[model samples]
Target: MTMSQQANDTSRNPGWTSTALSQLSSVVRGASPRPAGDPKYFNGDFIPWLTVAALTNIPESKTIVFETAGKLTEAGAQFSRTLTPGTVIIANSGATLGVAKILGIRCCANDGIAALLDLCSDVDARYIVYQINSQTDRLRTVVATGNGQPNLNTGLIGAIEIDLPCKDEQSAIADALTDADALIDSLEQLLAKKRQIKQGAMQELLTGKRRLPGFDGAWSFEELRNLVQTPVTDGPHTTPVFVDSGVPFLSVNNLVGNRIDLTDLRFITREDDQIFAKKCKPQRGDVLLGKAASVGKVAIVEEDFDFNIWSPIALIRAGSSVVSKFLYYQLQSRSVLTQIAVLTNSSSQGNIGMGDIEKLQITVPCVDEQSAIAQVLSDMDADIAAVDDRLTKARAMKQAMAQVLLTGRVRLV
Candidate 1:
């Protein structure tokens, strides 16, 4: 027997039944007035409104829908479907088809949304939402397409087959997954708070507005060219021939969160590496600032591995006047970033010339104070990274749990 058949085998899995979703809830498509965005049809204060854009905008870890960018007046509500709190909804059309959430407020939904109303009291709305999410890709295959975007209308949605478990089992499964989601949400919130705290620290410490203890040395401003061992330089002007495996080639995308990320790297030949290294070979203690497309982004080369940068990245080797770690953090400061922004030409993709970057001013402090501030910020980054890793694992665990629980492979009761 197939997994689906095994899942619905009442003899083996007691209290589980094979049934279409329409048996448990009334599936109804939302409505929209003709000429969407007409003054008479939209932009009034009746209730929160839902669009596929808003539905998909919600964080994937959240199941409750409470907020939206647009609202509709009573006149508009007459033309749309106003669903009450606790109703399960799915984006039934366009790219967001099959995305699901439970309404947390009474709101009118536009045509792109489908509401699952009058759910049987024994059915757990959250379990249904989780099930829909697990099967989003499969459901998309049933979408009807013609002149416009693909759509899952009421008839198509009501026909979706789902394996149902007993009410108590359903609630247990939903509660377990919801707890997993809450843990992930808390981790995400903590990460954001840590980042904000680091930003505030940077604003004060890097500018000399708040000096570290035992550091009362006067601060001085110096142009970047004066403190660099080499005239600020970039990689080769032309793209090198890529190879299957050689020196890892880096562009602005590789500069992630002040560190070089080699996960999605391209490659160049060893001969080409020698040529590029002469211009912009990255080594430990050097800082990289994004010069094009993603202006002002900065990352420090903290590893001893071999890598080469493209023209979009400018390399700076700090002279004895400044510590490399201090220079890396200083480049991330608002004062320096603002300077880069002002100098960047945004006509095409934004770019700052090497000469322009070299002319920018940097605030200097005693080496000891520079090291102190950098250490504090670096510690905070480590804390945030730790929490981020936990969040990723939490999300993955939730997905795996849903796969088994919603499929009736594991009984929660």
Candidate 2:
């Protein structure tokens, strides 16, 4: 099978897709960073190691951690039957489920993740790794045992099967998909550099360290009410009618620390946004600030998607007082977040209100300064956006390659 033929889902490969099944077989949990253990375990040169912590905010990749002290010695390696290099490791439980990484270096992980070993035999490991990653979520939804904890056991993993094809085809698929991954990683690095450049611009312009060519003026505190047009509104004091599918209901949880992940936005309906837009309909540049669950997390509603409100989320309008982009970054700055946290009502889940946000003071430069500052930051933001777009395309290319190659639709060497 060639790449083109394998890509067609309706073709013969549709049935089994030439795959295999397996599991971590043995589970190794993470170490307690503290507590009496041999100092040698942690005191050595850093090595690649993984924990669920590694999965928290990164995209799919190998070598998540840079520094590693907790590692298996030669003796430990012998006893543990660790998977060889190039094996895929994945998170099995908790907030992150089914996230996997191809191990780039010889390393081990704790309980937060399980290492799927023994890929060369019944299953071509790389191909099997792809199959496992693509299926785990669906596998997870269907498997049932206890609500106390959700997990995928070895038996569950082995039973989960894929369309079987010739091993040569499987190898071909893995190889093609790998090329796509390589392209994506390269683009991501470029994007990272663009963002770093922007951040440097922000630190200089906003701090007065480097002033752009033009007029200069002293910064002063401007009262928000007088300078601002849109005031912040607390989301529905009452609970929203949440359906699995509805208009995306915005909340602190929905707003990640620095940006809005449109992919994971919770839903409400046209009716809900209508019922709530008086307080929650956010515009393109409107800043979506978190008041309840977290004090100062801020994201902008850039998409045209209709969304409504939930507790702890406050919608702010642009009254022409503060630059939306400027305010967004300011709120995200370390100082503002720390300030908000300190002033917020502490609870199992943190909550703050519109009034509290309004009361917080901020320094304002003139409109010209605001525009100039925002321009520099906006350039940086644009650079970041461009880089992120490349990363997205890279991942998508890989996903497509996987669908084709793994299914025997494509053949490599």
On lDDT, the candidate that comes out on top is 1
User: Which residue pairs come into collision in candidate 1?
Assistant: none
RMSD of each: 2.7, 6.4
| TM-score per candidate, chains pooled | 0.91, 0.69
Candidate 1 lDDT by residue in tens digits, 1-413: 33355444644667787666788889998888667888887888877878888876677879999888888877888888888999999999867789889999988888899999999898899988888888788777644555667888888788766677888898899999999989988887888898899999999999999988899999999999998988999888898899989889999999887778888989999999998877788888999999987878899988787888899999999999889999999999999988888888543556898999998899999888888988988898889889889988998999889978877778888
Q: Count the backbone clashes (under 3 Å) in each candidate.
A: 0, 28
- Model 1 CA deviation exceeding 4 Å by range: 1-14, 33-41, 94-96, 140-148, 346-349
- Which ranges in model 2 have alpha carbons more than 4 Å from their true place? 1-58, 63-69, 72-79, 86-104, 107-124, 143-148, 151-164, 223-226, 229-288, 299-325, 345-349, 410-413
lDDT of 2 at 242: 69
State the lDDT of candidate 2 residue by residue for 159-223, as single tens digits. 55555566666666666666676677678778777766766765666656676778577776644
Model 2 vs. true fold: TM:
0.69
